[model samples]
Target: MLRALVIVPTYDERENVPIVVARALAATPDDVHLLIVDDASPDGTGELADGFAATEPRVHVLHRAAKEGLGPAYLAGFAWGLERGYEAIVEMDADGSHHPEDLPRLLGQLTDHDLALGSRWVAGGRVENWPRRRVLLSRGGNWYTRLALGIDIRDATGGFRAFRAEALRRIHLGDVASHGYCFQVDLVWRALQAGLTVIEVPIVFTERVHGVSKMDGAIVAESLRLVAWWGLRRRLRAAFELVVHRRRLRSVRANSSRVV
Candidate 1:
C-alpha cells in the first residue's frame, strides 16, 4: 500500500476544520494521513487541529508563526511530508471546496501518472454554488494560462491535486515563488517542464459554506503578471534557439558548397 499524506492549509477556519478532518479521514484508507498546516490563525484554528491530532493517530498539525499565503503553507507542508517519507503528497483546501470523497480517485491515478489534478474546466468536471461571473473568471483565467504557457492542462489553478513524491522532488520546490492561485499554475508548469506526466480528473468543486473567500485583487494581478512574464521568456528562448539553428544550417550549407 502506498503511504500518502494529505496536506490541508488552514487560516481562520474554525467552523470548517473539524468537518474537513472527519470527512477526509473517513474517505480514505488507514494508510492515508492528514496534516493540517495552520498559519497561526487568530481564531484558534491551530488549537482545533491540535485537538484532532491528539485523538487521531493519522491526524497531525504544523503550526506556523504567521499567516503566509497559500503557497508558503503548501511548500512547508510538502517539505514535512517529503521528510517523513510519504510516497504521495496531496494538496487540498480546508474550507471544503475540495471534496474528501474524491481523494480515493485522485490517489488511484498515481498508479500511472506523476500528478493528478481535480479539474473543473475538464470535460465532465463542474462547479457548484459558484456565480456565473466567477465561472467566467475561472474559465477565462484557465484559457489564458493554456494559451500563454502552451500547456494542455484544463485547470492549472485548481488546488485539489496529488503529487508523486518523486515528481515533487524533481519539481525543485525551492524555485517556486508564486502565491495564491498562481502557486497552483506555477507547479503545473514546473511539472511539465520537468517532463512529468500530468492528468486531470473530473471533480465537482463546491463553494465553501463557511468563511469568506481569500481571493483579492492583488493575487489576481500577481498571477496575470507572472503568467505573462513566463510566456514572454519562453517565446524569447524559442526565438533565440530558432535563430541559432538557422545560422548553423546556413554555415553547413556554405561549408558543403566549398567542399564541392
Candidate 2:
C-alpha cells in the first residue's frame, strides 16, 4: 500500500480548517495521512490544529511564526513528508477551495503519471461562484502560462495536486524562484522538463464559502510578471533544456555501454 500524505497550508482559516480536514480524512482511505502547515494564524488556528493532532493519529501540524505565502508552506510540508517516507505527497488549500473528495482522484494518476493536477480549466472542469471577471482573468492567466511555458497541462496555477515521491525528489525545492500561485506553474514546468509524466484531471473549483480569499491583484500581477520573465529568458531556458538533455544522454550511454 502506498503511503499518501496530503499537505494543507492554512492561515487564519479557523472556520474552514476543521471542515476541510475532517472531509479529507473521511474521503481518503486509511493509508493516507494529513499534515497541516499553519502560519501561526492570529485566530488561534494553531491551537486548534494541536488539539486535532492529539486525537487524530493521522493528522499532524507544523506551525510557522507568521504568514509566509503558499509556496514556502508547501515546501516545508514536502520536506516533512519526505523525511517520513511518504510514497505520495499532495498539496491542497485549507480554505476548502480544493475539494477533499478529489484527493483520491488525484492520487489515482500516480498509477500512470508522475504528477496529477486538479484542473478547473480542463474540458470537463468548471468554476462555481467566481465573479465573471475573476473567471475570465483566471482563464486568461492560464492561457498565458500555457503559451509562455510551452506546456500542454491545463490550470498551471492550480494548487490541488499530487506528486509521485520520485517527482518531488527531482524538484530541488531550494531552487524554486516564485511564491504564491506562480510557484505552482514553475514547478509543473520543471516536472515536464525532467521528462516526468504529467496528467490533468478535471475538477470544479468553488470559491471558499467561509473565509476571505488570499488571492488578490498582487498575486495576479506577480504571476503575470514572473511567467513572462521566465518566458523571455532564452539563455536560461536553453540551459535548462541542455541539462535535461545531458541527463538523458548520460543514462542512454550508460545503458548501451553496459556488458550484459
Candidate 3:
C-alpha cells in the first residue's frame, strides 16, 4: 500500500495505451496511480490518456513535445512522482508485454529491497507467444549483460521494475545518459554501483499482440557497446585503486623503517 506511481511511457501506442491504463488501474485499485508519459504520439495516444485522466482521479498524464526515447520519458515521470511525494515509482510498458496483474508482486518486494525488478529469467518466470529467435535474442542478451557488466541480475534489460523513491535518489539520475532499452541496464549498473539493495521478482512476460515492437538492431548494438565499455572502465578503475593502495602501503612501511 505504498503511495506508488506507475509510469508508462508510450510512442505511437494508440491501440494499447487505453487497454493498459484500464487494466493497471483495475489490478491495483488502491494507493496506486497511473502516469501516462505520452511522447506526443501522432496517433493521439496523449489525447486518449487525457480523456482517462479527466474521468479517473487515479490516472494522470504527462505530455512531452516529441518522442525522445524511453529513458527520458521515464526520467520525467520519476521527477514528477518524486516532486509529488510518491514512495515508489514503477516503470511499465504501454504495449502490454508487462502484465499489470503482476504489478502487485513487484511492489511487494519493495518492502525489504531498494529496487524490485520484474524478471523473466528467474525461477517461475516465463514468456508466452515469443518467437524462438526472439527468445534466443533476449536470453543471449541477458547472459552477455551479466558476464560483461559482472552484475548478478538475471534480467537487467527488463523494463518492468519498481524503485523505492530513496533508491532513485541514490542512483543519481542526473548521470544517466542511455536512451534506449539499454537504459534499463544502465540504471541497474548504477544501482549496484551505488550499493543499493536490489531484488528480482519472477513474472510472466507476454509478447505484445498490437503495435510493432520498438526493439531494433540499433538498440541491441547500443547495449553491447555500453556494457563492454562499462566493464572495462570498472576494471581499470579497480586496478588503479589497487595500485594506489599498494604504493601508499609501501611508502608507509619505508618511513616507519627509517624512523626505527
Best candidate according to lDDT: 1
Q: Report lDDT per candidate.
A: 0.95, 0.89, 0.93
Clashing pairs in 3: none
Where in model 1 is the C-alpha error above 4 Å? none
Please write out the lDDT profile of model 1 over residues 151-190, one tens digit for every residue: 9998999999999999999999998999888999999999
Clash total of candidate 2: 0
The 10 consecutive residues of candidate 1 with the worst lDDT sum are: 1-10
Model 2 agreement with the true structure over 1-260: per-residue lDDT tens digits: 36899998898988988899899999998999999899989999888999999999989999898898888889999999999899999998888888999898999889999999999988999988999998888889889998887778779888999999989999777798677889899899889888988999999888989969888888888899988888778458789999999999999999988944
Candidate 1: RMSD over Cα atoms?
0.7
Q: How do all models score by TM-score?
A: 0.99, 0.89, 0.97
Each prediction's number of clashing residue pairs:
0, 0, 0
Local distance difference test, candidate 3? 0.93
